[model samples]
Target: MTYKSDSHIRNPEDFGKVVVIYGGNSNEREISLESGQSVLSSLKKSGIDAFGWDPNQESIKYILNQDIDRAFIALHGANGEDGRIQGLLDFLNIPFTGSGMFSSAIAMSKVLSKKIFLEHNLPTPKFKVIRTLKDLKKATDIFGFPIVLKPNSEGSSLGMSKISKLNELEDAYKAATEFDDVLLAEEFIQGKEITVTILKNKTLPTIRVKTNRTFYDYFAKYKSNKTEYICPGTSDISEEKIYADIALEAFEALHCRGWGRVDFMCEKNSIPKILEINTVPGMTKKSLVPMSAQCKGINFETLCWTILETSF
Candidate 1:
């Protein structure tokens, strides 16, 4: 049986073959809903048996409580993207899409990720994770002004602030704590903001984010209409290839599976530095992964189906 909805694609066959785990009691509920809809649409189109589940408080119980062979995770932020839910799925012996617990954990924490990147000789922005305002002055002096303060374990640019003066450090720290305790202040790199989507060790393409805003904060990332995305970034094939290779290598180093997206910052030299990795990237209409995939002839629906097929 085929059923079509507002998203795109056919309904899943072999009903109950796969279950899509989505939504949660997280603040990013709207994005999660959009992601869930996209996944549901694609899963259905692929003729697979899949259904959507919120997995709210008792997510583990929710999965085991139901008859689900496999899970396609569509949740974002905190409980969903932070590896807690992935760990639950693992314990339940349920094969789920996206990276495993360890990978998700590393990707979730910015402080830990930068440490790993440095140890692995991967180019990443120098950052300091300050636990209190006492360490703020020291960190700022080292990283210098124009620092980006964000939660160590948050995504979607939530609780992110750019401080160019010492007086703003306190406010930035306070705002960042709204998301997580250890606040990360990275040396604000003045360059192009790039996003790379990878699947099966293959980096799709380089997407350069252009926004009228100062940095690609929450507004520029999710809300602002002033931002423009160039799928391939530039006409320079050499730079694009370099970014793609670096992104693929970074993805492999992080032990990501199936599909993921990496964010990078490129300096004037065209050197792309690792910003972070998104295990369960957004699949909404304006998401970077889908946009990058579409550049290579894969629509949002097909890109999602490919991820499902590859993951399980």
Candidate 2:
């Protein structure tokens, strides 16, 4: 394919042909903005017409009026990654990066994702969805103590808590309820924290995340350097292959495409259990997905460009 220079261009896109959707009504707005900026910068550096569009009043109106060819999603949590924006882009007939509506919806909801994983016979921590406080005990009975209590439909670990003792369950339950009506009392698998980043329906590289803290909580994940990550996960080639295989299967199982990340808990028993899938993985300098992608000779700029080019 021959490329044209600016002088030879008939009509160049000044405002950019690629619109980046970011910073919506999500708790992760700050990180989303960071991701948007980074992606925009990389796209611009790579000679692609790209610009950031926060999902605010003005941004929404402008995009609806504009003629961008495709969109790059940088938003996370809530209306951003919960299939709402994907549905909107679909309505506009604009091809955007990342999974589609059904896949985004399923991956965003903890309850729905766990169900799919369970149905696929994938190793995921067993859990019970608590419809009411009265059902907490039934959940604990099924999952046992040291369980992770999380809202069924939230992301970025917001309103998620790990209850090790019986006395901690109530408070954790109350906290998690602030985010959603339904909650999952997942059986906490005491082991290593790991993640898999996928792009274009392929697994990038497995990362074994080790934190100085007990687990990779919200604080440790985004705030503190309490975490240590091992690309390909300290596993031998064969073991890493196993993880990559499972990760790919889970990604396909969730119907994820374009790009996404799946998290897992690696137990000492050598069984890696599914945690959940992040349709919109963070793109900050410290994000894990980029780390995995970098392991395969794909820099952040190149990675962003590849995803954008695919949108065409």
Candidate 3:
């Protein structure tokens, strides 16, 4: 169902006690804290009896032991997004925002998700798995120079690098492996970067990301002010529809539900290549999902309310 502001529950009391999950023991803990606070504030402002829950401080058993009727997962990376917490919630029989355990695990792994993308005939960057120097050598030989190296399971552009030469491979691989055991060396698609946010099985406006950095790294995504975002990605209505359609298809391909974001790299006249899917995307002020929602006339409170409704 397409989620509009007016279609959501008007009374926040109906939501019961909600938990905004975030701040786990991950590389993205800081960001998760920010996202969780942002979501908690929005939910509270909307009158939804919501509070922040950091898994690092309190265990999942503690949370399940609470009176939480549903959860709004704002956590990113590692144990938080890797289906561990989702499984706990599933066992507790507590509804939560975003995809379930299976989909969460698949979406968190870059290697597995890319395989699904290819199997489903979805356009994604050509990629090769990297676990050793020998694998890196083979990837360099096949993909040539200017390949993107990133952890198999990471977010917020953490441990991602654009290797322009063979000498940089080892360093890039080392950085990525610090975050995940498996690394992915993908063909760098030189084009405009765009992201599409999906809510309630419907696509929101697309945002074209422009960064002065070599690529949209962790700094460019959250720290850099040089980044620019252009909404309604294309001037042509047909092109916009194409982007939205592809985004919706990609989101569904992974069985991603509730709400999520699909990132793409597109060149003129070429099909947009799916980069990855974010099941529990950020809710910070600089986040793409909230930015896209505002473009569609959905305020932060309404967006949070609509997302919480998905837990039902």
Candidate 4:
């Protein structure tokens, strides 16, 4: 499938002093820094007056005094992807790239995203919200072995674990709860790990991720060099379209605007189950969105410019 470049903005002057917000207090701070730097470099290369802002090192209120016209969010995890910054941007009447407050908050939480997906009759892995050890035990009993435990509001698969036995349950739960009070114990779907990138409400292409590690954890996402990405993940056009169609539906169901990425787990001869939506996906070198976008001939600088167009 061919994807037309969405780069409609011809002048960097149109952006008028853009700030790439990233490196917050979230555990994904390091990754966000990398993403922010990459985006900052691209935006500058495209001749945009872009700057990097790390809320962790400086006060967020300083942004208001900087006369910044808009923001290109590179932050991940809490305070970033969870809508706090989006709310601030909305309150300040400053347009930013990616989804608004409500959608960002909903998309950041795996529990909430799953609820919305189920309500829309979208296929998603069965999950139980766990607040206590008893709740974890109950979920384990229901889902049996080989279940997945993850923090509800974290991203980049941090504090996420796939348990293959009962002995690993306590450790997984302990690890996940460190990130968020609420946890999601989900039924692990053994299948192809697929992701779809959506830009300006259009699905770019599907990507299949292969990793030697136990699932796509934080290490596999950023550190592992062995990870392989397959663009247009499916072999047939019909299958690819099916994935793309469902991905767009899922994005709309979450009320997500601008750009985002929809994740899925697809088993052979079965429907793909939606995992979650990423409102502000990574812009790092190893990120999936850029890889999928590149497959459609959208270079990094042009992609950054196109995403900045979403701010308008």
Candidate 5:
């Protein structure tokens, strides 16, 4: 990915001593480690004073003692992206990148986010919360076969399954429930998978994802080489604007800030439905945010710098 030259860079000393927070005890620790390391290296390459700190292996006091001015959060899932760490940082009076506490909390919950989307008439897929066997039965009655089952708060597509029949529902539900007490059974929309990247309150570019696997599961997202990402997904400028508008609306509806990504499933006839919002998107080599950003003339290093600038 290549980026055109621009004037977005700031003085290195403006960042002070920065800590790239990643690799928590969350299920996404490995991916967080990769993203955090990538971010740390990028910040250093950009001439910023940056260091990596893993909350799982280090104490908060150690980080506080480092005299860090701000944090570039790369942690994913659970205590990381779900507002726990955001609250901690707020209490510490340190500015960090990405959404604030409440927005992060809402974005982390699939059920709550979808509920807000539905209430606001945002174009999200129909869903039902599955907690008991009776709730599962209700969901089957509502969505029937070919539904999606996944945990409410996990990221990186973890604990997600597509159910095609009644016989498969129980196993899929079991798999999802093992990850979170709150699971969601959603109507399956067969279409092209796409995502919109938001940076500094501006929509960067749209990415259309095509995967050979069952769906954009964990493997297809991070590990599989077969997955392809296409930027500027549509040929028509108006259609792209429509998708961008909806993505921006969804981001604002959740009160998101700094930077993030909104995913969509474009159904037949080019109708886009909001899937979910990613508050702290992956920065790994295979991550989509950078792919989308690159299409907008923002290289990985420049992207990290731009995101870090949000701390102010």
Candidate 6:
């Protein structure tokens, strides 16, 4: 099931008409547009009959009329990644890349994903759900200073904040709640940030993220040129195996299929703590998944074609 290339697909015509869905009315629309463009260009370069569709500019009904055989989801956040579009495509009987509706719904909610991870005995940071000032107070008492506050359901670190004192709690909560009514307060694991990319149930080389900023925020993810990415995240083979194993376990536990990315925070000599699962990760030039694939000798076009095969 390891999709290293398009070896199984002898001809691009077999793919039929493909639609790269992206740019929904989500806060991550800009990122999604870039990702969708990248994927669409790659598909065309590979001779696949591909077209880009932006939900914000058009309607879902229009896609049905266009005779799109399958979809390559490049959208992120809200309607795109929260299972709404997946469900719609399922009802229309069109296969799409990435997880099913149920899995997508669960993974979109950080709170729900954490519950599944804990149920499987997976290592994840301690967290508390916050809906009010009182809930934030309770969480601060448990996690103390330098706690991470983020929207319960968001991506690209859109509404995430790290607070180190009581005075910063309200501002952080307000910021996160701007994206989602519910928020998550997690224990800030002081360690290296690494991400694992999974394609067709196979793990790609891990990438360790380094940034001079306080943490890898939206700026560092897509905008910052100073950010450094170290492939094979850890030098030790055993440690790399640990990250890959945990990533696969987490992906399966959530019933996520196709391609995805699992992020982690690893403290020295400590087990890596799961951050969150990205069902439809970014596909822009600066994306981490492509970076990991490149380390394994899989070019971006090949990677895009392999992901499209998942719809089959």
Q: Could you say which candidate leads in lDDT?
A: 6
Model 5 C-alpha lDDT per residue in residues 111-230, reported as the tens digit of each score: 899888888889998888889756877888888888888899999889899988788877887888889988988889999888999887778778889988889999998888898888
Model 2 misplaced stretches (Cα beyond 4 Å)? 1-16, 57-59
Write model 6 residue lDDT over 1-312, tens digit each, in one string.
122222357689988898999998999999999999999999999999999899899876679789878889999999988899999888887878999899999999999999999999999999999999789989989879889999999999988999998998888888898999999999999999999999989899999999999899999998899999999889888989999999999999999998999999999889999999999999999999999999999999999988998873
lDDT per residue for candidate 4 within 1-312, as digits (tens), equals 112224366788967889999899898899899999999999998888988889999896678678888789999988999889999988888878888899999999898999999999999999999999889889989999889998899899988999998888788888988989999999989989999999987888799999999899888888889999999899889999998999999999999988999999988899999999999999999999999999999999888888888883
User: In candidate 3, what are the lDDT values of residues 1-312, reduced to their tens digit?
Assistant: 223322467688978889999999899999999999989999999888988889899866777668978888988998778898889888877788888899999999999999999998999999999989789879989999888888889998888999998888888888888888889989989899989899998999999999999998889889989999998777778888888898888788888888999999987789989999999998999999999999999999899889888873
Top model number, TM-score: 6
Which pairs, if any, clash in model 2? 210-228
Question: What TM-score goes with each of the models?
Answer: 0.91, 0.92, 0.96, 0.96, 0.96, 0.97
Model 4, C-alpha of 89: deviation from truth (Å):
0.7
Please give the lDDT score for candidate 6.
Answer: 0.92
**Residue by residue across 21-48, what tens digits does model 1's lDDT show?**
6778777778888889888988787677
Pairs clashing in candidate 4? none
Model 2: lowest-lDDT 10 consecutive positions: 1-10
Q: Cα-based RMSD of the predictions, in order? A: 4.6, 4.4, 2.4, 3.3, 3.8, 2.3
Residue pairs with backbone atoms closer than 3 Å in model 5 (clashes): none
Clashing residue pair totals per candidate (backbone < 3 A) = 7, 1, 0, 0, 0, 0
By TM-score, the better pick of 2 and 3 is 3
